[model samples]
Target: MSVDRVRTAAAARGLEIEIRESPRASSLEEAAALRGITPADIVKTLVVKGRGDQYLFALIPGDRSISWPKLRALLGVNRLRLPEPELALEATGYERGTITPLGSTRDWPVYADERMTGRRVSMGAGAHGWTLFVDADALIASYDATVADISDPIETIR
Candidate 1:
């Protein structure tokens, strides 16, 4: 049902997307490897809670992490946090790992890291054991997402 929702949403936007069944991986790197792509090509759809009941979807590359200060300044807000899993599900109609703006129950605003532009990226398919692939530029246009440098490269433990 969730995947169906995703399909319908994509169709409505005239955005072509590919949904593939995948075995759930334990980590971001592994997920990318399984998909035969670099970690950077995997986009993470994160739910960020703003003030009150407001929330937004952040599309960050897998090899990066949200830069709180940068994001705050970009949004002109002093506070933002990742809400609890239950709250995320309630907000997006999809669980944490399966959350994508395409099929969300609510049309939350989307913010995308600039690095994700000009590439085809894989992301959540609104269901477990599935992945959705789409052109990042098209997705940005489809959602009217704000594109900026709102993320930092993920530091790896040496």
Candidate 2:
């Protein structure tokens, strides 16, 4: 259902996207290897619960981690924590490894790490062994995401 929803949405936008299948990747590093792309090109969709049970999505480069301070500052909240896998699945209609910003059950606020702009990115496709590739900017536009520096300091590829 989730993959179908994403396919439908992208098709509606006239996006000719490619879906790749690979071994199950339990982490960003593993996904990167399967996709033959650097970790930076892998977009990690994180489900975060902010103040007052507010759920939000943060897209970060696989090579980097989320900067809690920066995220909190941007959100104007004192704290944030990851929702449990069950809660995330319930909210997004997809499990942890299959979660994608596309076709979420709720149109939560989306924040894409600034570093992902203008690049090609890979994200989950609502199922294990499936991935969706698209222009980072286009994905952000589709999600109506706000671009910001929500990444922790980490080594970057030049």
> Which one is best on TM-score?
1
TM-score of every prediction relative to native: 0.98, 0.88
Which parts of model 2 have CA positions greater than 4 angstroms off? 13-15, 25-30, 154-158
lDDT of 1 by residue, 19-120 (tens): 999898899889899999999999999999999999999999999999999999999999999999999999999998999999899999999999999999
Per-model CA lDDT versus the true structure: 0.96, 0.85
In candidate 2, what are the lDDT values of residues 97-154, reduced to their tens digit?
Answer: 7788677888789999999998888988888768999899888887788999999857
Cα RMSD (Å) per model? 0.8, 3.2
For model 2, state the Cα shift of residue 91 in Å.
1.2
Model 2 alpha-carbon miss at residue 122, Å? 0.6
Worst 10 residues of 1 by lDDT: 22-31
